[model samples]
Target: MNIRLHAGTLLFAVASFLMPTVLHADVFSPTMSYSYADGVALSPDVSYQFNEGIGLSPVVSYQYYEWPGDGVLQLSSSPRVSYLFYSYLGPTPALPTAFSTTSLPPTNMVARPRVPSGTQFLVYTSGAFASGVPLDTNKMTIVLTHGWMSSSDAWPKDMANVLTSQGFGATANIVAWDWRVNANLSAGLEISAARTPSEGEALGGELLYLLGANYNKPIHFMGHSLGTMVNCRAADFIHGDAKNSPGKIPGSTLKLNPQNTHMTMFDEAGAVGVANALSLVTYMLFLPTSGDTGDLINNFWTKVIPDHSAWIDNYISEVGRLHHEAANVLLWRRFAVPVISDISSGLHAYSYDWYSNTVAAPLISAIGHRFSFERNTLSPLPPSGTYFLQSADLIDSPFVVTPLDAATANSLSSGRALVYPTLQAYNGLNVAGNAYLNGLNAAGNVYLDGIQHAGDFLYDVTEWVLSDFNGQSAYVGTGTAGSTPAYMIPAGSAPLQFFWDLPFTLQKSTASPLALNGANGPIIHPADAGPDITNNTAVYVWLPVIVPSNTVGMSFEFKIVGAGTNEYMTMGVSNENYFTMESKFLDDGVWMSSGVIEISKYAGKQTQLFFSMNGDSGLPDGKLSVRGIQFLTVAPPTLNISVNGNQAVLSWPVITTGWQLEQTDALSSSNQWTDVTNAPGVLDYENTVTNVLNSGARFYRLKK
Candidate 1:
């Protein structure tokens, strides 16, 4: 059984428990008082008598009498005499056995006890339950219980006071279950602890009555310390009784089941299995007291705390180390850290202070704990889930979901893979047979030995960076010669991002007729003549281009290292739909230059420049290799000319330093152009010159 503590403790200074001033009153009192109301009608004294007992008994008789009177009456004895009266005969039954009183008999009064004494629920109306305040059962009901050595007048009463004085006063029925007798720690811990279950049973009966009376009302139970155990036992007992005798309480849907019940336990104590039977909608544990020796061992101190000797020393300290540590763990896990600590008392009493003053008061005073309550209100109480409560320093504190651990993260990145059984066979071989196959070739292609059918397997020669190749039949590469072909180039190899997809293998061969710069280059040949088979496959390489808005044209260079008969290559800038400076089929091995292609039309657009090569039917040994790919862009001219009266000043940045100025005149097809005769001079990285605009409507341009 998991014991979850539900209530959080505040950092308030722990107040010493004030010994309750025991009140003495008649266990069974029958008295009469009368008041005369003017204009009230009065009838003759009418009386009704009934025998009250399990069986028809004349020993006990209850007589109820009433005299109705109306009209203005004087303050006289005669007027007071005409009033209603009730009388009971026979020995009065003993007060509820659950009540704490020295006058009552010590023997048990009933086999199945009902209500406990001093358990009257107080109603609050807008934070006050002064005289004449009516109770509205239509509102939500919240029952609070005090722990061992504590009376309802202590924390229970304080909780009620907080609820009423804070926001819940107008919206909820705050009931302080005064099972002080059962919780009397003065009698000794064991003796008082033994009666907690019975006290809980009695409380459960009273709750059943309330539920029956106020149908479908939301009810919540909050207990601190041992009181938490009492609530758990009570819920379990009530649910068991309900299940055994289904019709015991008529018209009540609340069966003490988890769905209908909600419980909050604060620093729980007592037996472990108290709340195991209860299926609550929500169970919360608020642990404030810590450093208790027992708690450290229970929470596995050896695992979390480093240095076993220190842990032992801390555990045996006068101050509870385990208890406090446990509290810190709980608070931290819930992302409610930096909580104020109260070390005034060694015992667990801070839960009450925190809950009543901090948790509950804030909900009432300033609609806080919005997520904990329903509809952002305290009236409905919280729905079910395990809530770990804490006194947050701020309403919106940052919560850490998962903490980073380098060691654990590293282990995950290097964990070994486990093999599972499967029926599929690879290379026409079972797992047992394929396990022995080894040795990958220079192209990072794995070939199975002793396989009669060569075409049964397909090879995907994509370059890989990692070396741990296990489940995959294809070889993983290290991107080096005599290994796998290199797919990625060093950063900044070329300005425009380029990606290659030409089917080829990296081979170290100095026997090539063409002079290749690198020690090795990609080579492709007819499928039948090579290790892999191929049909009429096309080789294509492209680079994505972000043509600047000010681009004028583009230039690039390419070389065909080697090509056999019927193999040709074409290079150009293609937007998929169109191409610029598309070269004709070049079958001969030669370096080709793409004399500047006008690309201003494609400026400020996303485009790709592609090189495609096709191998047609020819010699079976036909092969082709491409290299020396490069691209460059020409920028648009940036020239400015200002005119003042008859003279104009022409200037341009050094980027256009090699440009010449030209002027054209005439609006017709017949236009004449001339270069400016004035020499230019450089100033502030700008080429400047003065020109005389004597002609009207002359057009000027910078020619590169």
Candidate 2:
């Protein structure tokens, strides 16, 4: 999951820039609104159109609310539309006229450059509300949803600060959705505020009308916490409008349903009627922690509440029933078989007592701040066959009774750590080493053991044993019986990088045979984690950094700040024996150096790059801060050579690459290729070369 943590305090800065020229006249459009109360509602009927792909108007508005402090809330939800832009289209030349199409200037935006691959996340920003520079929404749209307790003015400035610092220039729009005070004070309030039928309908109508009046373009939406509900309401309105309009063209704003709302289902569940009421009535009632209200409810009902209520719990059950009913004539058994197995495998002990104490209590105290839950003497009974079983001999026991430390304890508590199962027996075959092994959190920086394969292999990447989890007993049989041992894996896997470029250099060496490599250059020997720099400055490295693909890049962007007029430093990357790359600085340090070099060339198959920084000499003691590091792609490999042998021979370079080769018959191209011989990290292949000789000539090529 892509989750943006809470940014610090909100800070605002305002500035103006020259407007861009007309690229897509449909980009700048007006929003539609209607009056309900006064002789003239807050906003007048000011119809606007996108002329020359630009709409510039001075927004002057004034409004008042009587309920909370009767203070005035000023807000604006502007629109910026434009034509499609493709990276391949090349650079857009700067126009000389005031209507130049130069990209907007960078604003205050901060972002953690490294994010786990495959995790869908969003960046949020709140600060002094101001108009955003007009740019292409396709590249990025800063969905400025305000917090309920505070106005958009209270949003953390760091998010926008970091993003602007990066290259996302002119790609953000400040959207201010003025919500009622206290709307998001808690999950319950957020839910109640969004579910208010009439109010929700009105908000939806306003947004839909605005999109229609503006450009006819689709938009990407993002909501934070309670903002998720508002976004959902907006989506509901758009769906309703689409249903009502039929053939009519809706606004250019494409309605995003659950896609835009990244709230935690656990939070939503906590906001549910039962959860909410219980929480409100009792200050001590615990509830599951969640990222946002929406997600809390969604995940809770789907993953946790199976037997809680008939209609509520039956949501997924209905899906099963539908499949079963249709299976009579459809042969749905093929799909249903797996579904049933999955559901059965998911059979978990349901107990309100466990949830209240374990999941809910801690989560509420941790994430919900001041909220409390009501206590009840009537505890929820555990499901049948789910009673907690105490171990007569904790040493020989396989299961951990405690839920929290079960996985961890099971591995450590075992007297004989090596006596557990191997990974193969659990899955029936080796599953490790395959690049296609997904759904594993490895894509998100979650490290599993890296697999080494000489043949067809399937297993998990692990170092720790399942026996470690015996501490709590919950993970007794989770590991492979004999083949897949109950070994517990370490916190995260290695390729562990320790970086330093300050007072001294980092000394690194495997205390227990840890593998290490380098890039750019290495200035020190291998040792454990310790300070190498003598000068007062901090070093940096990618924590738990591992490669997603064979080819990747690592670097640090550093800038000198403070009293030193000129800063002197040296930085490099190196492996156990050789230093690959290096850089030296002796002048006033104010510029950022970003260069890309090949890690595959040096590291070969799988190697770890240790980045080191040295503050050999500098004016004042200043530290080096690494801003970014990422991956790049290489050209596809070619099917260069092949030999017709008994097993069909194939040969290719032994390099770190993501390319592969496949072959087909020239005559019977429709038939699938047979057996083949291969090499690790090689791009070339010859499938059944010996067998293909009988069929005359064969065709082959490399694939990316």
Candidate 3:
């Protein structure tokens, strides 16, 4: 017989194996709220009722010194409010006597309670009053919600505190919602899960009120685990309420459930709520951790629960594992040391501490998944869009967890498919001697090479996103060949004369030609020849030459740079038959005369001369100027042939340059050709060679 193990039993097995440290006992208590005076010895600057419909009591505003001691204390202000309401989304154990009798059928719906239930909200902002404060409406307003077994004072409070210390609290309002009473873990998972939507709706009502008050402010919602579901439900409710409203709310572009909010979900519990919430938010950032078992429980729940089974199943099949580790992936930004050991719940709890401690400046080190954002902090920010970041080691760094096997690397490198099947997939690591691989070809998705974790990526992403929100132009790269196209040298207006004083018509070219008359000829600047030169541009110049057959060598004279400057210029010669064979550079500012270059390989071929100027390394003023260019060709020695008896003798005037004697049966283009094997000896300037004429008719030529 096959026995199906339930979610609770599986969790029990997992817990038995885990033996996690008891951080805090699961506490179940009636909902309660304490004022600033009750919790701490602080006097309130102002007190007023907030969210009257939810029976939200009087909220007090206070300005507290940021740092603990007298090192350097700055008074920062954020209004804090605590309010409660009855949650209607939870399961009702019984129907009221007024609605049900012994014979009447029972109904799932129930009448609203006369008194508000214990759903609570705590708003933390840098503003002066509860509703209005000194904040930039154009900036983001962050709302943090906690998960099961945790109060708003847990991670949410910590996040708010960190954000405040990070200076985000000065310009942005940060709020934390507390639903600890309903989230009491001792009440059973099912009961607490049932209450999530109701508490979320209450939170949504408060958000709607905030939106109505500060209509233009953009809002971002961040939640961990169960709180992610709450954020989604709240966002949905807010969208629905705004859409169904009679009149348009000022400062808000809301048109009946408009998606204007940004939402980030951490290791979420339920898929249905998250999927639904996705529809109500404009942008979504999902972070799932590796080796988390939260998705297993969620997957098991889908099979056992009848309600929303299809939705849950779809979520499980599509985004299950991603939902479990979303928060874990973000911890790298908050923690200095890599989280290498902890599993499951222990791993989950570390996210809170990391986020809290992240208020201080991150430890900049190359030891972990940290990426250098120093370059990104420049004036122009990178474009706002999705970017993929891959880690070198997933087991330790954990940015993306795709196994980089040979097949995976090939697929990524070939761009045939994404390396990983999940969203966690990124371009493969650029191993030495291997081609760089990036999976997402979408224009918006950029692959960040070498960056490993979500925290570091997000830290950079946060700055980039903020810059985009502030309407700044994006920065890509400068001085690269891809960014700067090659510049061709144009033909001269007058026919140019070679070193032999033979005039040749100039060919049309792409390089820019200068009109400046120099001591020897027209002087040209590579920067001015091509398109406008930026700070770091590279330019190229091409010159075509028709060299007469039997030429053995070439010589040229040129000036590299202007006097007393460190500019650079390089010249190379190549023919149609061969690649660039001769390239030479002159580093000094003075002119160089009579530079000899071998052209024996292209002795009988037409050639094109190439000139390149690299501005990045050439000069501090970004100019590569050249003048006094002259070219000369060296003629080959005369060859004489004769026959004596059964032997063929060949003789040529020898020179210091090297040359090879070749022979062919016929001069036809398709005839077989070979190099003459008979050795030649040079006596003074005359060389002689003799070969036995044992074969058919033969033709000979001297090649250099």
lDDT (Cα atoms) of all candidates against the true structure: 0.34, 0.25, 0.34
Better of 1 and 2 by TM-score: 1
Off by more than 4 A, model 2: 1-542, 550-556, 560-586, 601-609, 615-622, 634-694, 697-704
- Put down candidate 3 lDDT per residue, 78-110, tens digits, no spaces: 224311111111111111111101121111111
Lowest summed lDDT window (length 10), candidate 1: 277-286
Each candidate structure's TM-score, on Cα atoms with residue i matched to residue i, is: 0.29, 0.22, 0.30
Provide the global lDDT of candidate 2 against the true structure: 0.25
- How many residue pairs clash per model? 30, 111, 19
Query: What's the lDDT for candidate 1?
Result: 0.34
Best by TM-score: 3
lDDT (Cα, tens digit) per residue for candidate 1, span 1-704: 22222221111111111111122112121332222111232222322221211112222221122111211111112211221211111121111111111121111210112225424433334433322334455776676776555666566656676666556756666765566664553322333433454566566666665555334555566766556556655555445442222333676455544334444545454221111100000000111122211121111100112111001001010111122211111222121111101112222344344444445435432212232332234345322111222223334431311211444323222211110011110100111100101112222112222211111111121112211112121112222222323232121121111111212311112233322323343322212112222432333334344454433344333444344434444334443211211112232334333322334455556565544444445212322333222122233446788997887888764323246788777655777777877887644335677877786777777875
- Per-residue accuracy of model 2 over 109-141 as CA lDDT, tens digit each: 111111112111123333333433233434323
Sorting all predicted structures by TM-score, with the top scorer first, yields 3, 1, 2
Question: Candidate 1: which stretches are off by over 4 Å?
Answer: 1-115, 118-135, 237-258, 270-347, 357-704
